[model samples]
Target: MRYLVHYVEDVTERVHAEAERARLVAALAAERGQLRAALLQAMTPMALLVGPEHRLELVNDAYKRVSGGRDVTGLTYREAFPELEGQPFFDIQDRVYATGEPWAATAVPVRYDRLGAGLEDAYFDLRYEPVRDAEGRVFALLSYGVDVTEQTRAHLAAERERQRLAAVLEHLPVGVTFAEAPAGRHSVSNPAAVAIWGVVPASPEVAAYSRDFVGFRPGPGAPGSPEEAARRIASHEWPLARALAQGEVVQDELVEIERPDGARRLVSLSAAPVRDADGRVDGALVTSVDVTERERLLAESEAARARVTAVLESIGDAFYAVDAEFRFTYVNRRAEALWQRCREDLIGRHYWSEFPAAVGSESYRMHHQVMSERRPVHYETISPLTDLWIDVSIYPEAGGGLACYFRDITARKTAEAAREAAVARAEGARAEAEQANRGKSEFLAVMSHELRTPLNAIGGYAELIELGIHGPVTEAQRTALARIQQSQRHLLGLIAGVLDYSRVEAGAVTYRLADVPVGEAVAEAEALVAPQLRAKGLGYAWSGAPPELHMRADREKLQQILLNLLGNAVKFTRPRDGVPGRIEVACTVDEERVHLHVRDTGVGIAPEQLERIFEPFVQADQRLTRAQEGVGLGLAISRDLARGMGGDLTAASVPGVGSTFSLTLPRA
Candidate 1:
């Protein structure tokens, strides 16, 4: 029985051992299936095993795609993918395998650029885990990763797109720039931008040909120097900078910029702020267009305006402009002179302050009326001086303004008054003279009739005596009757001279004109003045061309002019020692006219009174003691007659020296 029990125990131990072996087989198979499926689901997790290490004991199809490998069976890592053997990725895997502990890392941007242009650089998130045998020894490593190459490539592509856009903007023909909004600070710039600035030409040819700008400055009142200006620019402090910083459009803000040559250029800068998606100003886009021509035109226009102002100041008459409030807006040089006010003192002040309130009252009213009615007003008023008359006019301007013009007419007014008084005196003198002339004519007529009556009776008696109607008287008695006749004729001659003078004053002098020899006329006048010359013991001398050379003239008037001048000369001459008293009459003719001169080498005219001697009712002296004994109308009448005959009479003399009087007449 004991033997039988021992055999049973041995059998039981055998059964238990066999059952444990079966359970172990089933668990191993199930775990293998799960790991294989998991590798397929998470391909990158098993990518490590099939890498260039030829460790393909476990891996997925994803490892093949990433590695770009084909079949790797029965081959070492060198044979499978020789290029990957010494790569950085392989080195990282070796470390993971040696560590035997799980590892994961991030933060460093990954790079993988083995692909071509269409398929470029990618990134990854990698992990490695240790797989342990039942005995706790690690023989393999499990790697898990994500092929983030697409994400990395997409990010890189977006960056490239932005660069391309910037490049395109910089290379554009017109200069383009971006600055900070409200603070124009220069940021990143492209090669083309640097070239346009002339600060840093990137292209080799451009750099060689152009000068680079180290920086900009405000100088005294501008921005900063070129070097520091960049900072101010980056900060956006300039006009363009401010507008840009403020996100506003800057339109044609004229700015003076000092160029490299230390010259200023007028520039018109236009700018606007560029905003980001968040609606914040990122920078300003700007363009600067030079407008020096426009600036020059503006300066010229200003100079022309100043010239006009100067011209207005130079006119002779007072001129000024006034506002509706009677404020002086503009006053010219004459205005200031006439008002005794400074231009500065009155330009902005009331016009009434320039003159006394009591004075220019009419002018003040006219100014107001013109402005109020928008019409012109004119009047004649006494000047503020109160001694002169002025004609003043005020005209309204388009916009409630006024212009005034004034001219002084004091001389004209005085002349008019003198003319009226002279007319009154002439009328009075004419009435008195007419009454005196009537009395004289009556006396002369009665006297002539009384004297001539006796002469006629005597002449009749003589004729009867001769005819024997009565016995012939003795010869002596007949001669006595003839003497009476001659006396009567002389008296009539004196009356006729008086009547001729009166006729001239009464505007009744008659003239007969004919062609007469200038020389012959003078000889006849010398004959008439012969008696006066003989009385003064002066010689009567005549000079000129022959009588055949004639002058178209009133022959009687010419004789009268010559006789009057010669008679006056004979009257003035007095007998002197060795120097003969002489009256010289001379006449000469040219192609067109004849000149007759009456000269006296006798008592000469006084120099001081030569011109006055020609005036009627005037003589060198009023005293009756003077040798001259006739009314002072001879020269005046001669001048009048000469002018009437389209000729002129003139005289020249020296005190105590002989005088020459010339009469010019037109030729026949």
Candidate 2:
């Protein structure tokens, strides 16, 4: 066997290997201890041997100085040191015998009693192993230790601080997660990270977001996903990308992360390189902030740019918009065609000054209308050269000069003269007589026929359903027939309202003065509608309705109005998967008037035509005159009926979201 004898290099691994030779106790053939000693003597750490039974067999002299020069030879360890037994001193020897393998045991708190540790300032990393003779027979076990007390104490302090730091991470206001390098396993996470994970917990770990190197989800996809983003990163030779692969320190940088919430969060990630004592690369340290709200505000500012572009494209007439000098500023599709110029050519040229001959007479009136009125003004004049009849209007622009809208009306004037001559010749006397009485007589006959037909059917069905003369009705068909009967009654009320509007117009409508139970009528109407509301996923609730609320009114007419309004609210309200959409009916009283309001988050009315919505057969949506498959007479008749009962109906709306129709009546 060769003796190594001198320390020359980085000694940590060499010392550990030499220590292992003592563990091959049962497996030793011959000269194992001599061979192990030779191997250990060359380690960069100073080597030594204590006797198998606990006396110092030899020292490398480095051990003597560190151990403070105590002559340990031939002395029994447990006798000199009674504390060695409780510290598993025997197990360390026997572990070598059984497995014949070395196991590390350090920081057992051995005092350097003889080493001038008078101030209590030293510790060691001690090991025990079997020693073999030259003939490969077990002769003794060797024990050794190195002074590692300072390193051990520092490790313990660092562990304590690491645990405290992990606890503080749990209270982090923003999400924090760590991904280990190489494997990219989830090593640590804060409470905020857990919550954000729950929001879209498709996968348990954020490893899917890691780059080819050791980096977590603080990555962004600019023109794409991870693969495409990495390609861009490689093309740009990003420093973070290089550091993550090699475990180098990387400065903080912004990245894009697409969250499962379908939002883009801009994040800044910073990683610092971690290394072993030998300075070999180990891994990195990575940190994400949500910047979606800021980006959304920026996007909204861009929308205003789109609105400006839309205004420039919408003008349809033979319009000319120009600057202070009458230089053409913008021309839409038709305006470009009329000026006989391409958009590229027309945009920068002078319009009025280009044809300076035409500006003095007819063009002056067009230009004056905009500057003086500061509003759109219209006039008819012939073009000087073309002699074409032009109806022109000029609107003053916010930034500058005039925008003129003019149309040829030469044929219209000639047609008007012919019509004037024709009107002068005849027909005024005969038309006035037919227009006054004929329309009224026809409306009364239609109303009488329509109301009487439904009244007869309603009366006949009431008689039959009551007597069971039509045979036994199925439960389903009986429910249907009941709805039909209810509808017929509602139809009859509409006819009565039509008659009421006529009476009001002629100042003949009258009221039967009496106190009626308003709640009883509202309850009856609710019961009739409650079945349909339940079938169609509509919610029905009543509030501020006293059990015996009294009012001076016609009972049948008030019930009809409540039924119509509430039914409309229910029918228009849409639902999804059997869940009711919002429709609320509420009433409030302040002693003067009982305000009944039906509001719905259903289809609403447009603003322009809300004023005349109460006129007979005049619906807010005309092309959809029967869009909902209903006679539009309901609201018109309801208004007249309310006025007849000394009440009023008014509506307010926001298109697409909802409408609220209110009925205010004096209380008895």
Candidate 3:
């Protein structure tokens, strides 16, 4: 040992060289320690995978924390993250190890069963670097990752939202458009916008929007031509442009647009400024809806309303409309005239306030009832204000209102009142005339009764003188007595006829009605008139009535009527040119009546005097010198008797030919 250091030549240099080497080695180890410490404490998740199996060799605190603090050291990547077996991460790492090329991935999704918990998904930005031997062959992989789960999930969610909005905009029914601020240099439109515009135009600047969009403003003083429309819709005037320039929100601005195909459309455009986070207008959002049909329908409805108003104004009847609160909404000209107030004054005025007197009248009651029941009512009432009768009709409106139609009937009411008064006066005059006629009939009845006794006494005295009961009489005296008796009988007959007429006129006569054979009554009349007919040399014939053909009349009255008719026929008829005058009786039966016709070949009555012959004391021979029989009272009495017993007597006559008297009686 003593001999080893004896020949040490410049050993100090050798010792110094060894010391420097050690120092260098210690510094390198320290630096490596600091690097390892920094890597472990760093917020970034970092791990080292070694060998082809990609076994986890070293893991920092951040990496362990990211792995849920699982002990993944010395474990293969596949074993550490079993859920990642089928994931691209495992294969990506293998490729990075085999290729020895540095690899990086952003938002690489991984599944890890952290701390024996269920596998949870995490997003990461991953980096894989190959660790090579000195021979330059890939041996191990170094994997470092940042747990970018929250950032990556947020980015993915935003991307999904953008895609969803894109899809929605594509299919939206309402047209939507977006334009960038600062003159709208950039613009985009949805499919609906393209459809609404009829063609998708190139994106245009804000200044060119008016020229490119081809729209017109509507209403009064609107553009009359295409050039005018273009000029009117200036760039700054457009809804979208206004929103972008002035930060204005324009809603439901109706614009008429002419499409490229020459078809026009009405669009309801709404625009709002799209503000940035700083509350500065950066863009414009526009929505458009096609309202052409709606606008057209509204215009048609307005026209119809105008037409209805015109008709209401032109109608004669007063017309007015009232709301549910009884406030007047509209009034026509007639209504204004009837109310004696201007339409401007009546409109929007309460009905009861305008006509205070009618507040509790029938008109008010009916109006309330109609409104409540939604029914129509018609009534007539006197106007409280004008004191005129009015016909009112109230109809319920569909929208909780009422329509009223009224008319002034004052003129008609006045005329009706006047007519009723005239009718009353006429009725009084008729009553007075009937009373005078009854008085005259009473006077005639009393006078005729008073004359009948004197006439009968004169006739009895004349008969006694002719019989020579007081003294002897000559032939001349007997003839004179016979003449006096004849005159007395004729006078008595006239007085009896007058008395009968008076009784009939005074309604004092009575009748006993019974079914009498018409033929039997006619035969009895013929017997009574036979003697007179023989004296006049007139032929008479009777038509036998059927036994079953009976007349419902008083027997005595019927016989009297027949006798009078036959006697008149015999008296009026005279032989003309040696031809004997003839009288004929004919009987006929109808459904409910029997007619007895007495015909005579006598001078017929004048057409004008046909009716006058039936009057009392009137005859065909009206001259005082005429040779016809006594007064015409026979026919009048006969007609009165016939009518008293449910029968009528009528006559038809032809001048210079013949006369026929028909007696019509109810058949039994």
Candidate 4:
């Protein structure tokens, strides 16, 4: 009973206070659970890392999705994302935790080792906030992240495109320049622009453009002065400046520029104003191409054309030109006189219309042919209007046209006609002479045949009486018979010569042609003439020819020619002053022909009479009482026979010297 009196004085109050503290603790735990649930279900990616090792203490569903649905709640940050070891995210998280400072980054790049997706690259807008305990000492890190991969990639792609366009614009061959709107301040220029201007202006304003780029409008004649030229193409007149001020496009405006180096250049400029989305002028772009060489060539071409025109006007002949359409393009002074019309009436007019009478003429046909075939032609025609002969030449030009030249040839044509008339008169006289000669040959041929019949009858009667066919004969009667018979033989020989001459003139004799050996033919002729040579006391010599040497001639005709030649040589040669005359026969051969030469040291013929001796019924000595026995037809007959056998007889002689008779024939 005494021990039970312990201090129970306020124990109930202490128990009540303890119960209130327990309720407060339970409420706080419930609220913390609700907060955790809220964090895990959030749409944003969130994670909690605790301690120095950065163990992943909590991760939301959005965070798990970003990690390729990987369960990494109990893993350290390094273990969950091993691929991000070298990334700035790992170091940044450590720094945030160590400094107990909140850190944030936009478009930060990260690499992750996802569960089934392997390694992946992602961009994010991330924030790291430090979690502190009651003492304000950092204990854990809270990571808040937003996936900005698509947005960051789009922005990067736009930046790369801008850089590529800038590279292309820098390397263009044609000069390019850009200037800001309104003020026309130079903002961008390629290397080609600087090269064209020769120098870059120190100032970027439009007013300074002409300081380095002095220019003038292209036109004839020279610019007055440098200052005047600059004023002519001031900043306001420049194509680029005009485009910026007026919002207009200017194309292919030619400008002659004077560089700072004193070199002049011609440029073709094209400019247009750059527009903003609201269709307002924003800037101006310009392109320039240098055309100095091209302009110089054009000037030279004009000068060459003028020179050609002067040459055409100064030529002697009548000249005209026609285009491909056959319309007259030019008519010279001479051409105008020849056409009997002024150049104004002929030029630019159709050729046929100007000269209608020339249609269907040879000149017209040839002109058409020259144009169609692109060839040159020359022809003669008589003008229908003037009736004068003209020699016309038409030449095709390279530039689809024709050039024509004309010369008057009426005097030449008249001379040719007169010469043709004289030739006709001479031909008629020759024809009449040939007919008279043919009649003479026919008369001699008839008389020769008729006279031989009576001469043969007389020879038969004389021979019969001498043989005592009719009665007995004495020595006187026999002597009388011999004289008559000798007279008959002489008359018959004359008739035979006449007959041969007649036959040759009428072409009635036929030759028996063969390859006759020249040596054998000469030997036979020499034997026949041996008696005559002996009688005249003349020396005769034969120059032998090769046995194989032959001539393509008639054998009988060749023998006759040699006999006549040798006989004449024997007859003419005689002893003079006790020196006997010599007759020599020689033969020579070439690759295609043979020559038989009979030379005589005798009474040689005069040069004027040599050719006459071979004419019909002609003689060197025309006296009636000539010493020669037979008619003077021997040489003539021989020459005709030689020619009939495809050979020729020619004689060369001097009055006091010897004579050479050469007979030429084809060799086999």
What would the per-residue lDDT of candidate 4 be over residues 99-168, giving only the tens digit for each residue? Answer: 8889988998877754456777678899998988758999999887999888988998999998898788
Per-model clash counts, in order, read 26, 4, 0, 0
- The 0-to-1 C-alpha lDDT of every candidate, in the order given, reads 0.66, 0.64, 0.83, 0.83
Candidate 1: 10-residue stretch with minimal lDDT: 208-217
Error of 2 at 214 (Å): 99
Q: What is the lDDT of residue 266 in candidate 4?
A: 85
Candidate 3 residues lying further than 4 Å off, grouped into runs, are: 1-332, 341-356, 359-381, 389-429
Residue 68 local lDDT, model 4: 83
lDDT string for model 1 (92-162, tens) is 65666676667776422443323322323346677777676789766666766777767767877898998
Q: Write the per-residue lDDT of candidate 3 for residues 115-188, one digit (tens) a residue.
A: 45678878888898887765999877767888888898898899999999999998999988776775653267
TM-score of each: 0.39, 0.29, 0.48, 0.52
TM-score of 2: 0.29
**TM-score ranking, high to low:** 4, 3, 1, 2
Best by TM-score: 4
Report the C-alpha lDDT of model 2 over 338-425, residue by residue, as the tens digit: 5556767767788755656577786776676577677777788887635778788787888767777776788998998899888865
TM-score of model 3 (CA atoms): 0.48
